[model samples]
Target: MRRSRLSTRGLTEGAIQAALVAVLALLTRYVPLAVLATTFLMPLPLMVLTIRHGVRPAVLAAVVSGVVAGMLSGDLLTGVGILVAVAPFGIMVGWGTRRGWSGPAIVGMAVLVSGASLVVNGLLLLAFLGINPVQQYGEMVLTMRQQMDTAASLYGRLGLGQEAAESYRRTMLAVLDLMPRLVLFGFVATAVTTGWLNYEIARPILRRVGHPLPALPPASTWRVPGFALWLLPLAWLISALGWQPVTTLSDRLRSSLPPAPLPVPSDLGLNLLALLSVALLVQGVIVGWVFLGRYRLHRALRVLLLLWLTFNPIFSNLLLIVGLVDSIFPLRERLGRRAAPAEVKP
Candidate 1:
């Protein structure tokens, strides 16, 4: 039985990996529009692949993403550069797993991956685009300002405070300080999602192939609100502990902000209300977790997560419809049995 299960698990993973690669390859045909409109989507699949299989597999997948992207866009160097940049996420995951690191450690690794990708991409762009390094860096600053402005505008509309708006803006740029690690975090998160999805999709197929399913980790009670709440304190704790250095860096960036008119509001009440609303929302999330046991909540959350990911860049409106259908139908749950509990070998 064990041997059969092992064989099945291998086949399932292999099949899923192949499917992902093939889909990504096909999607490459749309890279031109996708890249100019939204660069975020380009590296995402490669990042997901890296998270699941570690560096080697991620690199292999990236190679494929690169090839397809190159052919479709006629930008082989850029495609290959993106692949090279993203592949390290797999390495970070592999290194972390091998070391048996904690959640924060994994997060740190992700930060490294993001930073490296950003740096490598930036350098590559500068070298090939016939742009001076200083000019390129200045463009990055402008780009960041635009993103900050967008974030601030949204927050302001929501009645968020100047301090909070500023804080958030600072955080956005501050993330660049640990770009590689942040990217890695994104990759790792995506990886975990992929693993869960794989297990779900693979289990039934393996069983049909005369193999037992790979064991799955016990489900977490997934309350979206609750999960968000739990994450708040952890985020706060990290921020508080890391504030000094962050502030020092922020001061430098603030000095660099163009001496142009600020669009951010100065309303204290709006800001206060915004912050309070955010807090209450977080509190509600935590309370929901307590009220709802983890497992059922987790199931709903997982479905939502998968839907969002599959439709990422969110242009594939069909994926959203599919998500709604899956949420209503839940074929995965109804069809697949719970994986056998892993045995403790100690």
Candidate 2:
């Protein structure tokens, strides 16, 4: 009787969560304004189901939600899309939460699962729908290029100066050149962002339900692993040696022939630099936050100041330098509130 009761309760909860997911999916389909918020929140119900009832019921809930969503929308793929987008991410996060994983570890696992779902399911979805990703991407690039050219011309007419307009065109072209190479990284970044957002949204709700999620460690204590110090040099070596995994894979994927391989771009190094620069910029913000703490500024003020520094082109470069220096030396241990340097003789 006890086992039967537990099973019944689990099925009841799973059904309720599946209904919620279908409702959210319908809202996304019918309501335009709610998409930005609702799109991310769609995973929450199923996530809670996983946490409360476990994976088996969560899987059932996901299947029911997908079918209900498809049937309601009159297109089966829409249901598949909903499942592909939200299920893996939500389930992984719930699993991690149940296992008492740290915030970072949870997000890390969730991102990988989310990214894999996007790529693998995306391919199958496109195959099912007879859509060509390469052709779609090409059309997107063409439209963007045209818009950029128009903008550059408008800038020239607006007296932003010919030099400024030309520079802008060059910059935009560089970005366009990089887009294909960075698709994998873009997907990974999207996964990371979504995982973090889900974790944030679920934290308070979980606490309210008597299950508290782990919080992130303070920014000051956050350290890039020592091995990461070698990434910058690796980036340089990739540039020097022309080992273009990103570019080569990108080329092969877009190619019609299985054996076709494209020559490595001269600026394959730029791809590595672009990824590393973004990472270092994050580290730099952490370093800057630590330094700001020394002056005892309010937390809000420090965050605002960091934002300003990051957005300012000049200061942002300086921030990257600070991050690199901090990574190499124990800047936090040395500059923290306690522990003056031995030579300083405090």
| Candidate 1 local lDDT, 2-81, one digit each (tens) | 96775555445544553454445445445555543233333344434443444555555556655755666676664665
lDDT (Cα, tens digit) per residue for candidate 2, span 173-229 = 887876866665566677778777777887887788777778877667776666776
Among all candidates shown, the one with the greatest TM-score: 2
Q: Number of clashing pairs, model 1?
A: 22
After superposition on all C-alphas, the RMSD of every candidate to the true structure, in Å, is: 15.3, 5.1
Each prediction's Cα lDDT score? 0.48, 0.79
Candidate 1 residue spans exceeding 4 A from truth: 1-58, 132-134, 137-346
TM-score of each: 0.34, 0.84
| Candidate 2 structure, TM-score to reference | 0.84
